[model samples]
Target: MTINRHCPTCRSRQDFRKLNDDEKAWVRAEGSRSYVDNLWRCTAVGCLTYFRIGRINDRGLLPEKFKKEPPADAERP
Candidate 1:
């Protein structure tokens, strides 16, 4: 998912890459949520507006959360 938004400060485009839909507060199962990665900011500088790249997935599958790497100590076992 790509969230494209125009920054009024920089007049540049701020893009955000959406990863998946994860559960969150103020949002229900039927509600919409987006996870963004590789967030990009205006190179022009001065634009504080942050835009997340998000595209609605028409598929039936819901967005899954990103898994963090296991601890190195745990791997020793």
Candidate 2:
């Protein structure tokens, strides 16, 4: 399922989808809970940037959180 949310990369509100099982697992393996259930991906063509859905601190804007490859010790999703 997809929902509309603000995408910092797109610099506007865009369609977003939750991370799949494998993607969630990858986030878990990265050892960061910040992006576990809160991460979303922009669905715009040629713009698949991942971002955090929740806010951190007092900032009222959604922050983009790009995904990186899993660590060497971490299993690939």
Candidate 3:
């Protein structure tokens, strides 16, 4: 099964490509507990952006954590 989340840039639901071992290790090192942040790239057409999702209970990454409110000063994609 694929884990999909909304793209922060495009606001479209997109499947993500899993990060490599090095990237996963880096994220794990940066966080506490077992809350390893996994990096994912937006797979929607023309909306290739990167975002992070947190792993939960060793089950899987939760997509809800990936949603972010756009900064008021930021431009929409």
Q: Flag the better candidate by lDDT, 1 or 2.
A: 2
TM-score of 2: 0.55
lDDT per residue (tens digit) for residues 33-71 in model 2: 644677776676556466566641211212234444446
Q: Across residues 2-55, which tens digit of lDDT does each residue of candidate 3 receive?
A: 578766666566787765565456556656324434556555544435555653
Query: How would the candidate models be sorted by TM-score, starting from the highest?
Result: 2, 3, 1
- What TM-score would candidate 1 get against the native? 0.24
Each model's TM-score?
0.24, 0.55, 0.40
Model 2 alpha-carbon miss at residue 9, Å: 1.1
* lDDT by residue (tens digit), candidate 1, 14-66: 65333333422213344543433333333232232323324222222222333
Cα displacement (Å) at residue 60, model 3: 22
Q: How close to the true structure is residue 30 of candidate 1, measured as C-alpha lDDT?
A: 42
Please report, in order, the local distance difference test score of every candidate based on alpha carbons. Answer: 0.36, 0.61, 0.52
For lDDT, the strongest prediction is: 2
